[model samples]
Target: MTLKHILLGTIGATMIAAPAAFAGSVTPAPADPVVATPVAVALTGDWTGGYVGGQIGFGDVDAGGSDSGAIGGLTMGYDHDFGTWVLGAGIDYDFADITAGGNTLENMARLKVRAGYDMGAGLLYATAGAARADIDTLGNDTGYFAGMGYEHMVTEKISVGGEVLYHAFDNFNGSGTDVEATTAQVRATFRF
Candidate 1:
């Protein structure tokens, strides 16, 4: 035979006999579906239900006639979650060292409302409420506040966050000095 015919015959013979020569030990692959074990994940903390916590922070309040340096305060609040809506109401007390002449300021209280969403990792919220703080020169000036905050959960029962608030104040003591106050604070909350 010619070289080309011999090579072709060899290739044809190999192809025709290859499958049967290996058939004695050839095993079919399993056709079963893969079963993955379900993993169990722990839920750390839920931002639902009634929550009460206290906070202390510093703030500056300017009421046109006088400017307050640094104010210290305490706060308590309850927050409720109705799935998509997180509703909260709280109050705070602040003692400010603000005086233009010779008057000492007393305690300031604020009643606030909050609306927010708990986005798995943290709680993102916006707050607004009526605030009234005592002044030496102007008595009590009532105002409103708008702010935003993010609470990162560090544990099952503890979270820390920072927030900024803008306050608009009414004129006091006929001074026509409406004030805008902004405060930034780091806060830690204990969840029970």
Candidate 2:
């Protein structure tokens, strides 16, 4: 071959092999940066404040004869939370008309003290209190009461609960009759 032919062939061969020879030396593009996603967590409620609320329930009074009826009322209270435990005081009034034999219960009121355990969004408690009951014929009488209750926070400001209370009164309104009453109530409250 002539010098021109040899030079052209060498240039073509170099052009063909240039890309393959430089392929190993070329640096690859950097990989995409790693991205981390955040995790979500649930929040619990705190119970340490004052509250006002209402309650509705059924009451059964055993005075000579058994008389059961519906009872409803208003309630207000304050509470202090100490981590795993809580304590509070409250007052409530109930309007009722339960009749048995010759006696009729007109209404009732209670002043209570309670202690409970904090369970995330819920509370389990025990209560004891002084109760007053008014009878249509026998006037009014003072008594003692004990109960158990469970309450849950439905929102930051609202709560719902249920309670079962037992009451005892001796010589109701000085009429020489002993009275025993049981009440089961559902309650809703607004917290501050």
Give the per-residue Cα lDDT of candidate 1 at 105.
Answer: 53
Candidate 1, 1-192: lDDT as tens digits: 899999999999999999888776567767899899999655444676444444455566555445546565666677776666577777766666755334445656678888888765477899888877666666677877889887767777777777777777766545576766666666777666
lDDT of each: 0.68, 0.91
Stretches of model 1 off by over 4 angstroms after superposition? 1-45, 65-68, 98-106, 173-175
For model 2, how does the per-residue alpha-carbon lDDT over 157-178 read when each residue is reduced to its tens digit? 8999999999999998788989
Residue 55, model 2: lDDT of 95
Best by TM-score: 2
lDDT of 1 at 164: 74
